[model samples]
Target: MTTAQRLPASLTPLDTALAAVLRDVAAVTPVELALTEALHCIAAEMAPLRAHPPQDLAVTDGWAMRANDLVGASSYAPLPLTAPPLWVEAGSTMPTGADCVVDAGAVDAAGPIAQVLAEAIPGQGVRRAGSDIAEGRTVMEAGRPVLPRDLLLARAAGLATLRVRRPRLRLINIPGGEATAAFIADAARLAGADVIRSDAPGRDAAAIAAALDASADLIVTIGGSGVGRIDAAVAALSARGEVIAHGIALQPGRTAALGRIGTTPVVALPGAPDHAFAVWWALVLPVLDRLLGRGRRRTQALPLARKIASTVGIAEVTLLARLQGSWRTLAIGDLSLDAITRADAVLIVPGTSEGFAAGTDVDAYILRE
Candidate 1:
């Protein structure tokens, strides 16, 4: 099972390769999905036709009255009412001309006339119209992932479904990389992709090429991307399409490759989990974002607990943990399962820069929401 070594002759810059991959790429057409099903999907603009609480509503279970009627009402000199005030429960619509609510203790109906024993202020126990959501205002913006809280607004808007762009991703597993492929597939699903996974019959070029000839917005091949004799993913992709960049300037994932099969963009990832994970963040996710029409991802700028030095001309992945309000370096270049599991954020060191100095402010993508 020993394969010969064949290193790359030249490494392509990360930015250059990324640009080439994104060239001519556009977001997928949007589709309507059930509100709950749209969670994590890239959302289209969500604006309500009308405001929630279309009319003023009572905020408490009590009698609804006009503020002016009880302005001078007090315990010693109770004000008499011509008629009993309308009763309203919490969340019920207020009666016409009624702008205040009072507890049962504040009103007495023992005599012929109802008495108000407490003063009231306008809007003291009322939820005004459009207070929860304004009409014609955007509740959810396009290109952002649908969150659970967003569903609250959707429900208020009386929306049964949401419009979203969910790209279809096909992951082809070259033999001997089932674990890595499974990991990538799960990650893609979490990113709101409709992931379809299949395995190549063998590790040969023909088997891999056959797997690459499927229809999808994006295709990813796991394993067999290196120049080793049996590593044939690059060759397989070349046979069916174009290999834009075979060797990228990325540490731990230098063997990763990018290409396209006709209109479908393809990425060849190494079998190693850490290597694949690095490329997933550094390369694959960007393409996924483009297809989803997503905007800038959430990131935080914080001072580093220590210096992170990197080799010039190669991009390196850094795993970080937020310790005492600062980023503590957990692992760099080669990542372990423990580090990956414990990571709170991720930082990518560009190939152009050597690294960041201690106490320097660095931007890192937040891993946990």
Candidate 2:
């Protein structure tokens, strides 16, 4: 038998095995795109822009005045004005010879003459030019993810277009009897990668080989990657390509195959939904980061509400219940579709000692939105 003939109980962390396969994988080239299409994307550098108000405008409804005109004004004895004070409504332009605004409600008018009830301050109740944004200010920096609210700010800053880096990725996908492989393919990894699919059985070595040869920077195949009849994924890579390592020391994802077809690395994963997810998290994910030249994925540590034990030396990945906002162990043995449907995240326990305590903190990586 070959290396692919082994099982999950005989494997290491998917990350470790993948490191061996992706030997010499290089980063792809970057491209520039418009700001709108750059949302949720990575950029190589920051862009600078600024905004300035057109002219002084009224921010409130009041009477425009020379501030000194309101001196000693009071409700009982109002100040005498030369002519009727001009009305300046909110958002109106500053009136001629006006340097301040006294609220019209503060004083009433009698016989075409208005009285001031209190004193007014210079530049008061006025929206100054560039108040919302300063001149030559950096509105949207490079490398920042474009948010929905960015457009309005950008427009206010007087920018209609943005320059950003585009993510480039190449996918190598393996098909399963079910939609599980397609589920893995649909994932947006390391920013960008087009998923490629195949329909051959897991054991068809010849068919699997042709699929890998088509076109892809990375190779991923699903099903028959584990120990079973045919074992086409293993046979395809080991015979036609280079086999880096097979089998793992983890549970639920032990049958993972790490190898290379031509110079590109290939990750063969189990067909189960949860298992495929596990391999991608442990193995394929980091490779994506390395290829894309990005940082490792970080996660918040959430304490487990329940305890769990592993059956073997192989690392076991358990589905989580997320009780009371804390990640709790899921019923693994049940493995029911409904149970998986209700799961929030998958918890991985390293293979070695028997089990862990209920209050232990486990890093629960989120699976869905």
lDDT of 2 at 113: 68
Per-residue lDDT tens digits for candidate 1, residues 1-369, read 544335468899899999999999999999999987898999876544688889999988999999988888999999999887788999999999999999989999888899999999999789999988887776588989999998888888888999999999999999999889999999998899999999999888889888885589999899999877889888888889998998899987999999998888999999999999999999999999999999999999999999999999999999999999899999999899899999999999999999999999999999998
Which structure among the candidates has the greatest TM-score? Answer: 1
Q: Candidate 2: worst 10 consecutive residues by lDDT? A: 164-173
TM-score of candidate 1 versus the correct structure, residues matched by position: 0.95
Please state every model's RMSD to the true fold in angstroms: 1.9, 5.1
Q: What is the lDDT of candidate 1?
A: 0.91
The reply for model 1, stretches above 4 Å from the true place, is: 1-7
lDDT of 2 by residue, 1-369 (tens): 434355533456544665686679765454555566655554444455444566678889988888877778887887867687788889898886677878877767875766778888888988777777777666555444455566667667766565444333334344443577656766643244534555663346777776666356677777778766656677787876887877866566677778876777778788777677677767776666565555434455777687777765666667787677687776553355566678787666666556677787877766553
State, as a TM-score between 0 and 1, how close model 2 is to the true structure: 0.71
Colliding pairs, model 1: none
Candidate 2 Cα outliers beyond 4 Å, as residue runs: 1-9, 21-28, 51-178, 189-203, 213-217, 238-241, 261-263, 292-298, 331-339
RMSD of 2: 5.1
